[model samples]
Target chain A: MSADNLTRTQRDDLRTIAAMIVPASDAYKVPGADDPAIQADMLATLGRDTKLVAAALDHLARLAGGPFAELDANRREAVAQEFRKVGGAAAATLVRVVLQCYYRDDRVLRSLGLELRAPFPKGHVLPDGDWSLLDPVKARGGTLRRAP
Target chain B: MKDPVDVLIIGAGASGAAVAWSLAETKMHILCLEQGGWMNPAEYPSTGRDWEAKFYGEWSSSPNVRGRPEDYPINDDNSPIKVVNYNAVGGSTVMYTAHWPRLHPSDFKVKTLDGVADDWPIDYDALTPFFEENDRIMGTSGLSGDPLSPLTHPPMPQQPMGLSGAIVGKAMNKLGWHWWPSDTTVATMDYEGRARCINLGHCTPACAQGAKSSTDITYWPHAIRAGVELRTHCRVREITTDENGMASGVVYYDKDGVEQFQPAHVVIIACNGVGTPRLLLNSKSNRFPNGLANSSGLVGKNLMFHPYAQIYGYVEEPTDSNRAPPTCLWSKEWYDTDLSRGFVRGYGVQFVRGAGPVFEAVVSEQKGILPWGEDHHRVFRKLNGHRLGFSAICEDLPEEHNQVTLDPVLKDSHGIPAPKIDYTISENSRKMMEHALARGREVLETAGATDICINSPIPWGGWHLLGTARMGTDPNRSVVNEWGRAHDVKNLFIVDGSIFVTSGGVNPTSTIQALALYIADQMKQRLANLFD
Candidate 1:
C-alpha cells in the first residue's frame, strides 16, 4: 500500500497502459481513463493496490526487456501484447482496478446514458414484457415425471 | 441462562427464521442465536454510484472473501467448487437470487424412480401444504400451471418477465421444450408485510429495495413479533449434551467475546449444511464419542452442491438487461431422468439477464472476448446490454466421498473449528452439465444470439450447500429420522438444508423453509410425545 515503493517510472507506465486500455472515445464523447481528473482519482485509489500495480509494472518491463515508460509507442504495444499473453494475478488486479475506476467515473457513466447515482432510492424499471410468449410451452405441458 | 428455555435454535438464517415464526404459534419460550447481525438496506452497496466497483469488497457473497467477524472460514481447497454464503440474519438469502422453485414429486423418491439416490423419508406430496404456506408467507411471485414444478401459482402474481425472458421463452418454444416464468420469492406488488420491487439489478450483493423476500425481511420480523427472541452476534462454539445422551443446549461467545452456556428443554439446529455438521462433529462428549447424534457416521458425509453451467452469448437487440431482476424464466426440459442422455437425473435451466457495465467489462476481458486495447470499445459495445444467457443448475447425487469435515487448522473468530469441504463434481452431474450446455447453446442460437460462451461447472456456484446431515428411516444411514428429530438423541432436531437426502436441480431455499415449517408443525402436533 506504500506509494513510496512504486517507482515514478512505474506510475507513468501504469497511466500509459490505462490510456491504451480505454482510449478517448470521440464518437461516444467520453474521455479516456487517463484523463487528468480521472487519472488522479485512479492514482489516489491505487494507494492500497500499489503492490499489485508495481508487480504488474515490473512484469511488463521484464517481459519488454526494459522500463515500460521509456518504451516507444510501437514497443509499448508489443510489450502490452506480451504482457496480456503472459497474464497473471497482478495484471488481472490492475485491469480490474482500472476498469472499475473508469466505469465509476461520472463522465463515462453519462455517456452510457445511465444516472450518475446509486441504483437504489430510485431503482430502475422495465416494461412488463408479453407473457403470452409461454403459450406454446403451455400448450405442450406435462413434462414432469411422476413419483413411483 | 439460569432458566432453561423451552426451545433453543441456532443460526437465525433461512430455515431457523421460518421454524421460529411457525413455532411461535405455540407461544412457547423459543430463542434463536445468530452469529451475524441484521443488515441495513440503507448501507447496501446499491445505494452508491460506485456500487458495481465497490461491492467486491464487504458485500462479496463469498464468506472467505468477505471475511467479516461473524463469517467462518471454509477450507474449500479440496473442492473444485468454492462455497459462497453471507453471514447475516437472513443467511445466504441476503445474497440469494431468489429463484424459488420446489422439488418435483419424483425428487423425493429418486431410488424408486431413477434408482440413484436414497428416497426421502417424506415425499413432495406431504410437503405441498407447507410449501404453499411458505409461499404465502414469503410473498412468492409466479404464474400458475408450471407443470414442471411441484407447486405452481405462488401466492403473488407472476413477476413481469422483461424482454430477456421473452427472448428465451420464444427460443425454448422453437425447440419444443419446457419453459415457464420462474417462481421467485421477490415481491411483484406490495404485499402485506413487504414492498414492491423496483428492479435494482444487483440481486447477488443484496437488494436494497426490500423487494427480495429474504427471511430477515419476511420471517424474522414476524417471528420477533410472535415472541421468539433472536440474539445476534452470538457464535455458538459447540452443542452441549446431557448425561443421558438427550438434548441439551449450546455454548456460545457473545458480542463482547464472553463465553456463556444457555440450556434448553429442546435443541433445534437450523444452521445450513456446513455449519450444522461442523457443530455436531465438534460437540464430542463421552455419551456420543464420535459426535453428538452421529452414531451412523454419516454426519458430514454426502455433501451435495448444485453444479452451475453458465451459457450466454451476444444478441443484436438491446434488452432491459441490468435494469431488471435477472432470473424470471426457467426450462425443465431436461429436468426429468433420461437414461439415453448418459445421466440418471437432469438439470434446470434458469435464464439470466445480461450483465451490467462493470460485469460486462470485467467478465468479457476475463473471457478474452473484449480486449483491453484498440478493439475494446467495438467488442464492448457489441456485448453490452445485448448479452443473454441461462445457467444450468445441475442436481447432485449423494456420494459419501464428498463430505464436510471439521477443519483442524482453520477456526472462526469464536475459536470454533471451521468446516472443511471435500467435494468433486460427480460424473453424473458432469454429464448433466454437458447436456445442458449443448442444449442451452442451441436455444440461444435459435434466439438470434451469436458469440456463444459456456463456462461449465463453474467453481463460484457453490450457493446451495445441502445433504451433509441427511434424513432417512435407517439409523445406520442418516443423522435425523423421518421428522427431522435425531434418532440418537431425543428432543434434538435439525431443520435446515443439512437434512436434504438429495439435491434437486432448482434453488433449495423455498424447500428449506417449507421443511422447517413442516418440522415445526410436527413438533406442535406431537407436543405431548415429541420427546419420544
Candidate 2:
C-alpha cells in the first residue's frame, strides 16, 4: 500500500475517500479529489506519511468489508465518517494530507474564483473594508501605559 | 585567511548585520561569520505550489524541525514552549511576520514602574535616535505619531488594514480600548533597492518579492559595500581569549568542516539568546570555568520567552484573508499593569487575518471542530473568508531557574554543544493569559463572531528569545553593561536580544537592531581603548 506503488484497489479506495472529502459539484465547477492531478499530487506529497494514508484507507476498507470504491456514494461517505470517528494518528494525517493537497490544486482555486498563480511577483489586492467602525476607539483619544 | 581584523562579529542575522553596517562606517576591518548561507529570494515558497509545506518542512522557521546542517537540536524536554528560529544570514527576520512594534517607554523602566523585572541600563529616550535610524535604514511602514512611540514618521506608508483588522478594530472601539495600525518592516513602496510589498499575505517562510526587510537584503548589501567581509557557513564553536583574559577571536568550523581560528582585536557576539549563551558556556577556560564573560553567572540565566494566547473566530462577512500580511491592527489597552486583574504586568493583542485553507483545516482538526463526510464542506465554506484570529503577546519576567544550559549529549554538525531549555510559565503570565483570553472572546462576540476557538500557551510561540545575557548597571547581576560590552571582558561585546533586561510585550527585532547600532557607536567612540 505504498503511496508510489499503491495497489489498484488501494488507489481506488483513496480516490473514493478523497472525493468524499472534496466532492465534485456543478455549483463550484471544481474537480473532486478523485481527479488524477489532485490524487497524484497528494500521493507525491504524502512521502513519509504514505503509511499513515494507507492505514486510513485500510481502515475505511475494513469498515466497509470491501473495496470502498465499489460502494454507493452515501455508503462511501458513511465509511469516511466512521473512519474519522475512530480518530487516530492515521485518520488525522489522512485528513490533513487530503485537505492540503486539494486546496492547493489550481482547479480548486479557480473553482473558488481565486487567481490561479503563484503569490509572488504580483500579489492580490484587497478592497478597503469599512474602517469608520473604528471611529469610537479613535475618538477616545489614546490610552497610555502607566508612567514610569 | 587574512590578517587579524579590527572587529570580528559572529552570526550575520538582525543584530550582527546591523553591527556590521554601523561599524563599517568607521572603515574598520570588520568580518562577520554566519552559521548558514545566504537565502535566495527566488527560491521562496511564493513561487511554487508547495508553499504551505515550507511551514513544516526543511524551510520551517523552527531550527529543531528545519534540521539544516548548521542547526543544532534543542532539548526542550523541561519546557512546554518550543523555540522557533532560523539559522541563516538574515536569521529569524527572514521568516518573521514583520510586526515591528517599538517597546513603550515604561518597558525600559519596568523595575521602577512595576517593581518586577530589572530596568534596562539605557532608557527609551537614549535609544530613540537609534530606533529612528533603524527605521530609516529598515524602511518601516506605518502611520507617524503613534502615541506610544517617539518616532514621528516612517520611511514608507502603512500597509492597508484589511477586513479582519477593521472587524477587530471595531470590537476594540466597542470595548473602548486602544487600537492602531501595527508598525511593520514591510515596505509599502519601493525604497532602498527593495521592491514594494505586493501583499502576498505570507511573510514567513520567505518573501520572494523582496518586500520584507530581512537583513540579508536590508543591511548586508550596505555593509558589504562598506568593506565588511561576510563569510557564510562559518559556525563559531567558542569565543577564544588571550593570556590576559581579554577577548581574542573565535574557533569556528568552516563550510568544509575545517576548524579555523580567526583572530580579531575585538569580538562581538550577536548569535541570539540561545546561540550566544551556548557558545559562551561551551568556551570553558582556566580563568572563567563557568563560561566566558560569565563572572556574574548570568550568561544563560533569566531566559525570557513570551507566552502566547491565541483566539480564533468565524465571522458572517467574507474577507480577503490572503490579500494582506497576517497581522495588521494591534491594541495596547492591557499592555500595562492593573493589579485588579491579579497580574502585575499585562499583554498586547494583535489582530490577524485567518490563515490559509490548509492551516484552517489542520487547526479545525486539532480543535475537533472539523466535521466529517458531507458536513465538511458546509463547515469549511462557513470558515473560509469569515475567519479571524488574534494573539495576546504577554510579557515574561526573567526567572533564574528558567534558563538555557549546554546539552550534555546533543551537538550540532560542527560538534558544538546544543542548548537545553528549562522553562515554566510563571503565575503572573498565566493570570495574564487567562485575562487576555477572556478579553479576546469578548471582543470577538462584540464583532459579530460565532464559534470562537481559544488556545492558550501556544506551544510554538517562543519567537522573541531574550534576557539570557541581560544588560544591567551592576556587574554582579548581569552579563553586559549599558553599552552591550561584556562586564567581565573589556574587548567582548554582545549585541542581540540576549542583552535585554526585560521582555517587552512586542516583537524585539527593532530594539535588537537599535541596541546593536548603539553598541557599535560605543565601540567607535573608544576604538583605541577597546581592549584596555
Candidate 3:
C-alpha cells in the first residue's frame, strides 16, 4: 500500500508531521518536505514505506490523546518522542523515505548546487592541477624494500 | 558447448577474463562460464538521474543486498566486514573505483620480513614483467617515479586530480608524507581503443562512461574476437572429476535453469576466493570424500579482507560535486609497517572526492545530524558538496580461523550452496586503523577540513576478497601451489585472489591480473609437464 491509500485525516497528520520533520527554512531558500508539490511527490513514491507512515500517524494520534494534526507543537513533539521510543525502526524508515523524496526533488537538488541530470555522456570536466606540486616528494626520492 | 573442450574456465570475472585472454593466443578452444550476463553501458545507473540511489538497490556492492539473479548470495552475517562483488563479465571490476596500485616487493616475503603470513612462491620481481604487460592491457593511467614500486611508467598520463585532490596533495606535501598521483585503470588518454574518461563522478556500481577498465570492455571483447567463447548466465554448481582424480568438466545451471555439463582437458577455477572454494568443496566424490583437491584441507582457509576506514570532513571551499573519479591521489606514508604502532602491515590512504547530492543526504540522515524541520536544510547544506576525505585500506593478515565455508542452509537460485564468511578484525588491524585515523585526521585538518568525522573500520567495506586458497609450496598448508595449480588435482588450477599469500595494503587488481597472466604463461610453458 502507498500513501495515496491513506485517508484525508491520516494524510493531514502525515503532512503536519512531515513539516515538523523538515519545516521550510528562509536562509536555506528551501521549502519544507510537506510543501504541497513535495508532499504530493513523496506520497506518490511511498511504495514500501506506506505502512510505516500510516503506523507513525496512528501511533502519534494515540500518544497525543487526540488528532496529531490538532495537537499543539509541544504536545505533538512530545508524542513523536514517545512514538519514536516505541517505533524506532519505523520512524527511521519514515525519515528515510521523506529525505529520499525531498533530496530527489529538482528544486531541492538545485539548492544543493546540483543539477538533476544523469552523470553520463555529458560528464563534467575536472580542472587539471599543476604537476609541479610533486617536486618536493621527488626530491626526497625513496625506493621499494626489495625482497631477497 | 564443446563435448571435450581444451580448457574450461569457471567464472568470467577478473582473473578468468585475463587468463582467458592470455590463453587465447594458443587458440586451443578456450571457454569461460560466467554467472552474470554482459553489462549494457546504456542501462547502467549513471545514465539515469537516480544513480546514487541505485547503490542501495540493484547495483549494490553487496550481493546479499543487490539480490540480482546473476548474483549468488554470500552469507556474511557472521563477518564484520561484508563481502562485496559484482557477478558479471567483469565481476567486481564492474563496480570498482579503478584505484590501481601494485604490491610492493616486501609484500611477497611476508614471512621473512614480518614473520606473519607465509611467503609467496612468486615474488614481485618475477611478476613485474606481467604487471607491465597487464598495465598496458588494462589501459593503466599513471606517472612513473613513485619510489614505492619498481620504477616504470604506465601507458597513459596520470588522471586529472581536480582542486579537491590538489588541496589534499598540498596538505600531504606540507606534512612531508609520501603522497603521489594514484595509478588508476580509468582511461586518461586514447592509448587503447577506449577514449579519455569523461569524469562520470562515481565509477562504482557501474561506469556508464566506459572509461574504467572493467575487463568487460578491456579483455572480453579482444578475448571473444580471438575465438574465446564466454557463455553467460551459466552458474557452475560443482567441478566434475575423472576416474584419475583430474578435473574433467563441470555441471552448471544454464540461462534457462537447465542442468548442463561441459567437459574439458584442463579446468581453471577463477571464481574468486569464495566461489572457488565453494565449487571445490561441493565437488565431493568417492575417491576424494572430503572434496576435490582436499588432500591439503586448506581450500577455504585464511580469509583476508582489506577492511577500510573513512575519515572525512567538510571543507570550507566549494569542492567539485563528485565531477571526477572517486579516488584521486593516494598516500603510502603509513604503508610501511612500523612495529611500534602495533601492526605488522600498514594501509594505503585513498584520497577521495566528495559524495554526490543523494549520497550526501543519505549519509547525513544516517548520521542523525540532518534533523527534520528547520535544521534539516541547514545541516544538509553544511555536509553536501564541500566534503573531502580519505579511506584507509588496512592490510588484513591471514588467519586460519577467518574462513569461507559452504553454508548448509542457504543456496543460490540454482540450488548451489552459498559460501558463508566468518571474519574478524585482529588486534593488529585495530591498532593500524587507530594510527590511520590519527594521521588521516591530521591530513584532512591540514587540507582545511573542520569537524573531522572518523568512521573507523567502515563495515560493508570488504571490497578486496583474498587469501582463501593461499599459494605456498607446502601441500599441507596451501591450496594452490607456486604457479596457481592445485596440489591434489593436477589438471585443476585456482587463479584469482584465492591464491594470494598475503593481502597487501593496496588495490590487488594490478597484482591479480599480473598473476593471472603469469599463471597462464606458466601453463603454456609447462604444457608437456603441466600435470606433473
Candidate 4:
C-alpha cells in the first residue's frame, strides 16, 4: 500500500520533516533513512491495497502536527523528535501497520531510486561457527534449523 | 486406538530438536509435535531494531519477559518467574544467543568432589565423543587448549570477533585465568549455504541470514527432508499407555482444542528441563500415579538453574564492543573451585561485548536512572561504545526443595497447569557469586577500567535449564538411566538438560546435544533388537 495519498502540500511537509531527522552532515548526509521521495517511488509498485499507504501517511501527519510541507527544518526535526519521545503504544502500533503497507509496495522504490530485488549485501551475524573439528565417526548432517 | 509411532517428540526447540536429529538414524517412526506455527527465513522476524515490537511483543527478550500487564499468569505486577518462551515450531531456538560451551568433566561428578549435589551416572569421558560430534553438526567455534576437548581434525575455521575479545583475553591472562574463544553455535564463516557472521546488531528474534545454528535452521529441516513429519500447533496433553505398560499413543488437543490421539510405540520427552517434567507430571496414568515414568518420584525434583551475576564496566573512550558479532571471548579458569575459599563449586565467567541503546537505557533505568529524556540520551550515547558487561554463571547445586510445582491456580491456553518455580539461592551459591564478583572486579582492574558497576546477583534464567529428570545409576533415585532411558520404562527416553545430574557453571546446549547423540547411538543399537 502507498503512504496515505498525501495532498501536494502534505507531501512537501513530509519531505521537509524527513530531511531533518538525518540532516546533511559532513560525515553522513542521509537525506532520510525512509524518505518520502523514495516512498513515492515505492508506492507505484504496490501489491496489496493502496489505501493502507494513505492511512500511514495520514497518521504520520496527525502525529507531526500541521501540514508536513509547512514545517521548517527545526519544526520537522521537532516533530520527528516528539514522535521518538511520545511514540508509545498508539504511535508505534499505527506506524507499524503503515510501514507494512509501504514495505509491500514495489513502485515506491523506483520513484525513490531504490532497488526492490537487491539483497542486503552485508551478511548477518549468526551464532554457529566451524563444524570441521568434529570427528568423522559421528558427524551428523542436517539442514540448519530456523524459526517456522 | 491405533498403535503409536515408536517415539513422539514435543516442543521442537534446541534440546528437543537435538534429541530428534540424534535419533534420526533409528528405524522407529518418530512423530515430532510443536505448539507453535512453522517459520521461514524469508518471513522470519525482520532485521530492524524495531522488529521485535511488531511480533506481539510478548516473545521479545526483556529484563522481565512475563508478558503484557494482563495477558497471562506471569506479568509485570506479580511473578518474578518471567516465563518468556515462544510457542512456535522451532520454539525459543528462533531467538537465542547461541553460546554453546560443553560442561567441564568435573561438573558431572560434583557430589563426589564437593560433597554437594548427586554425581551423574555417566561422566564427561562417556559424553566427550558425543560433544565432538555435536560441535561438527552445530558448527561450534573455539580453540583447542582445554585438556577436556578431543583433538580437532581441521581445527577452528574462524578467528574470534573484535577489540573486546583481545581486551578480555589480555585481562584473563593477566589474572592467570584460562581464556579461549567461546565455543559458540554462531556461524563464524559461511557454512551449509548460510552466510558468515556480519556484525549485525540483532541476534535474537531470528537471524536474518541463517547463520545462527538454531535447531530449526540446523536440524528440523533435515528431519523433515528425511521423511520426518512435523506437526505444529499440536499440544500433547497426555501419553496414554496400554495394559502391558507400554506407551500406545499420545492424546493431544489440536490448535482448535479438538481432542486427537497420535499412536506411537515409544515416546521421547525432550520438552526441555521445565516443560519435560511438567508434561510427565501432567501425563498421570494408572500404573504411574505420580506421572508417567515417574515411579521414582524424582521426575520433577532437584531442579537446578545456573545462577549468574552480570558486572558492567564503563570506560571514558569508545570501545568497539557492539560493532562486531556478540560474544567472542570467555574465561573458565575459575570453573573448578578450590573449596578452601569457602565456596563449594565455582563459576564460569564470560564477557559479553555490549548492549544496544534500548537495552542500555533499560538497565540504566532499572538502576533508578531516568529512562527517557536528555539524561537518558546522554548516558546512552556515552555507553554506546565504551561499555562492557561480564556474566558469571555459578554452579547451582540440585536441591529437592527448589522444584517446579504445578501452579494450582495458573493454566496455559491449552488448559494445562503452568509450572510454578519455587527457587531460592543456596548459601554455597551465594558465596560462589560473591567470589565471582570479586574475580570480575580483579579482571576490570587488570584491564585499567576505573568506572565499573557490579550488578547484584540474580536467579538464573535462559536456555540453560537442567537437572529435573536426572540420570543416575540407581533406579530409585533417578528418572532415567545412564543412557538417558527411563529406569522402569525401557522404550521411553529423555535426552536434554532434564537428564542432567549436576548443574554446571557453563551453558548446557553443547553438552545436552552431546548427550542426545550418545543416547541416540544407544537407541540405534537397541532398535535392531526391539523393532526388527
Best of the candidates, lDDT: 1
DockQ of the candidate models in sequence: 0.71, 0.45, 0.66, 0.06
How would you encode candidate 4's per-residue C-alpha lDDT over A37-128 as one tens digit per residue?
Answer: 44464344332333443444465578667675566657766676676465554433333333332333344323323234312235323333
Candidate 4 lDDT: 0.63
Name the weakest run of 10 consecutive residues (lDDT summed) in model 3 chain A. Answer: A84-93
- TM-scores for every candidate against the unseen true structure: 0.97, 0.93, 0.95, 0.76
* DockQ (model 1, Cα): 0.71
Which prediction has the highest TM-score against the true structure?
1
Ranked by lDDT, top first: 1, 3, 2, 4
Question: Residues B256-340, candidate 2, lDDT per residue (tens digit)?
Answer: 9999999998899998888889989999899889999899999899899889998889989876566688888778888888899
Interface RMSD of each: 1.5, 2.7, 1.7, 12.3
Q: Residue B239 in model 2: shift from native, Å?
A: 1.3
Pairs with steric clashes in candidate 1: none
* Chain B, candidate 4: TM-score: 0.91
- Tell me the spans in candidate 2 whose CA falls farther than 4 Å from its real position: A1-34, A48-91, A128-135, A143-148, B149-152
lDDT of 2 by residue, A1-148 (tens): 4476667888898888877777776666777778899888887777666787788878878999999899887887777777878848787878788788888888787666667777887887865556566566556666455453
| CA lDDT scores, all candidates in order | 0.86, 0.84, 0.84, 0.63
Better of 1 and 4 by TM-score: 1
Comparing chain B with the reference, what is the TM-score for each candidate? Answer: 0.98, 0.98, 0.98, 0.91
lDDT of 3 by residue, B1-532 (tens): 7578899999888899999999999989998999999999998988987677667657779898788999998999998888888899999899899999988888988888878878899888889889988888888898888976556568888888787878888988999988889999988877567878899887877778788898999999999999999999999998898888898899988999999989999999998888888888899889888788878877788888887888998888867767889888888888877888877889988988888876777676666556656677777777787889889989989998898999999999888888999988999999888889888889888888876777777777888888888888999988888999999889999889989989989989888889999999999999889998
Model 1 chain B poorest ten-residue lDDT run: B53-62
> Could you tell me the interface RMSD of model 2?
2.7
